[model samples]
Target: MNLEELREYCLSLPHVTEDMPFGEEILVFRICNRIFVLTNLERIPVSVSLKCDPERAIELREQYPDKIVAGYHLNKKHWNTVSLEGLPPTLIKEMIQHSYDQVLAKVPKKETLKFI
Candidate 1:
C-alpha cells in the first residue's frame, strides 16, 4: 500500500487516530494515544514502523530481508520497519492489526472498551 492507503487502513481500525507528534513529516497512528504505526511522509515508496511480537519480528525480517527490517530508531526487539512497495496488502494489514493488538494488550481492559 501507498501512504494514502496506509493512512486509511490505520484509521479504519477502531479508535485509531492520526497525529504528527514528531513533526509534520512523520505521521503517527495511535490507539488511545499509544502509537501503533508510524511513517515518514517524505519517504519514497512508503514504509511504516509497527509494533510487533518479538519472535514474529525476527521471523518477518528473516523472511523478507530487504522489505522488512529492524525498526529505525525503535526498540529492535519489539518493532519493525516494513517497506510497503512490494509486500502483499494482506500482510501489511496484518502487521497493522498486530500492532494495534499489541497496544491493546497493554491497555487496561476497561479503557480498551472505547475501541470496541
Candidate 2:
C-alpha cells in the first residue's frame, strides 16, 4: 500500500495516533503513546517497520527474503522491516494488527485503561 493508505489503516485502529516526534519525514504510528509502526515518507518504494512475534519474525524473514528483513535500529528478533511491494495487503494488515497488539500488550493496565 501507499503511504496514505498505510497511514489511514494505522489510524483506523482504536486509539492509534500518528506523530512526527522524530521529524516530519518519519511518520510514527503509536497506540497509547507506544510506537508500533514507522515509515520514511521521503523514500521511494514505501516501507514500514513493525513489531512482530520473535519466532514469527524469523519465519517471515526466512520465507520472504526480499520483502522482509530485520528492522533498522530495532531488536532484530522482535521487529521487522517490511517492503510494501508484491506483498499481499491482507498479510500487511495482519502484520499491522500484530504490531499494534504487541505494543498494547506491553502497556500496563492503568495506561491501557486510558485508551479504552
Write down the worst ten-residue block by lDDT for model 2.
1-10
lDDT of 1 by residue, 7-112 (tens): 8899999888898999999999999889999999998878899999999999999999999999999999999999999999999999999999998799998887
* Stretches of model 1 off by over 4 angstroms after superposition: 113-116
Expressed as tens digits, the lDDT of each residue in 1-116 for candidate 2 is: 88888988999999898889888899999999999999988877988999999999999999999999999888998999999888999999999999999999999999889878
Maximum-lDDT candidate: 1
The lDDT for every candidate, in the order shown, is 0.94, 0.93
Q: TM-score of model 2 relative to the true fold? A: 0.97
Best by TM-score: 2
Model 2 / residue 7 / CA error / Å: 0.9
Checking candidate 1 for backbone clashes, the offending pairs are none
